[model samples]
Target: MSLPAPLDQIAVRRAVEAALAEDLGRAGDITSAATIPGSAAARVVIAARQPGRLAGLQLAAAAFQALDPAISFEPEVEDGARLGPGDVIARIVGPARAVLSAERTALNFLGHLSGVATETARYADLIAHTRARICCTRKTTPGLRIFEKYAVRCGGGSNHRFGLDDAILIKDNHIAVAGGIEAALRGAKASAGHLVKIEIEVDTLDQLDRVIREGADVVLLDNMPPPILREAVMRIGGRMLAEASGNVSLDTVAAIAETGVDLISVGRITHSAATLDLGLDIALG
Candidate 1:
């Protein structure tokens, strides 16, 4: 039940507030308002309906707190905790209206982030014995990249660059536009700050040779099979960080890892992970 470092409270607060706004638009929980008395209170337990790695607890708590400052959200598990079926994630007690109003928003955060974490864990665990690490790419859900990346870490996976601004990854298009790999490398090197590393993607070992000569911090071996990947790693010989991208899946990740590349970047972990099923049930006091 290890916990990752706490998410930025400011970020969590802003995201939760915005989500709550979207859900409680205009009239603001009219269903709850119409049915529940002003003084009515209720207790509930949010439980996992399937196995997963937990994440986004802070956002879940913030969702309820935004509506009712006095709401009690006693968490039974922390982010990064591996959950089992029927496990109670948290206990909530508050104004019945606030509880009902915040339920969907809270579970939305929990389920989505937990799903990302759970999927990442599946890949990470498979390649645990190998030197390679599982990494999530920029193909993340819009407006939810930070949360999803954090969830990846909670699942024992590493993160790729957070965005285009964080690092320079010269893709095939960039090379084509810049005239060639050498030209792209020259341009990126000239423009980059001292702290920034330049990474260039290459499809074939010929391009990799040019990159090795041109010099870069990391080389992305795009879509190469395990045999080619192993050869590329040998060619690089620890000169630049070796990363494999494209066509990576649970079935083939182990083979990719055994090739000795430093990172295996998978986009599906964030873009296509299924929502972990979770539900809030009103508790009888």
Candidate 2:
């Protein structure tokens, strides 16, 4: 599937470059030196060791290509496809030393990201009956936010702000520092350009009421109980979008979605997702 137009492909490529740099450092893979010769050629299959969703194929290919320009990647399965154990997701032919060098880094990107997508897809499936949609938050790996959020989309979850510049989010800190919710709301609204919509995070119904009175475009109902979230949704009454966030786990997402909120932002999707099981098996021609 094509990535969203709003996504900057250059930025994504740069991120992959940065990651490759971190792994390669000044000298390229030193470990591959003692084992594999420079002119060696090999064919490898990236296989899924367990059944789950797949994502980040192109990014992984980019990582390998960065290591060896001669590397060729043939994706047998597309991103966002559900796979079973023993499935060959990709076939790669390249310099043996370069393939060995890029193996772990490439698998690291795909495994962790595809794991997030798989986990998010499970939550999305749980809330499929509800009007609420699963969304991801800014709580991502420091530099890997784009990749993580992209994986979220692959899993059927929507993305929140990619960064602070793209949207105005007045959280509790902003309210405390700005004096009050109304003050923060007014300040954000006044300073924001016509295109910027402000979303304020509120922990209580009382705070929610105040923001509603001040006119917020979106309210992130943080850590609210199911009853309170439902009440907040009714209070807002379609005037603004109600977003349920905090403590959102697979077990609780369905209940949160049942509260009639427009969105559910889960942080754990990217922050703590386990890497999916995958491996690259070299084949002899």
- CA RMSD per model (angstroms): 1.1, 2.0
Q: Candidate 2's residue-wise lDDT over 1-285, tens digit each? A: 344333366875787788878888998888888888878899999999998888888788888888779999999988888889999999999899988888888898899989999988889999999999888888898988988898998888898999989999999998999999989998998899999989999999999989989998899999998999999999999999999999898889999999999999998888888889999998757
Q: What is the TM-score of each candidate against the true structure?
A: 0.97, 0.93
- lDDT for residue 57 in candidate 1, whole number 0-100: 92
Off by over 4 Å in 2: 1-9
| Candidate 1: clashing residue pairs, number | 0
lDDT of each: 0.94, 0.89
Candidate 1 ranges with C-alpha deviation above 4 Å: none
Worst 10 residues of 2 by lDDT: 1-10
lDDT of prediction 2: 0.89
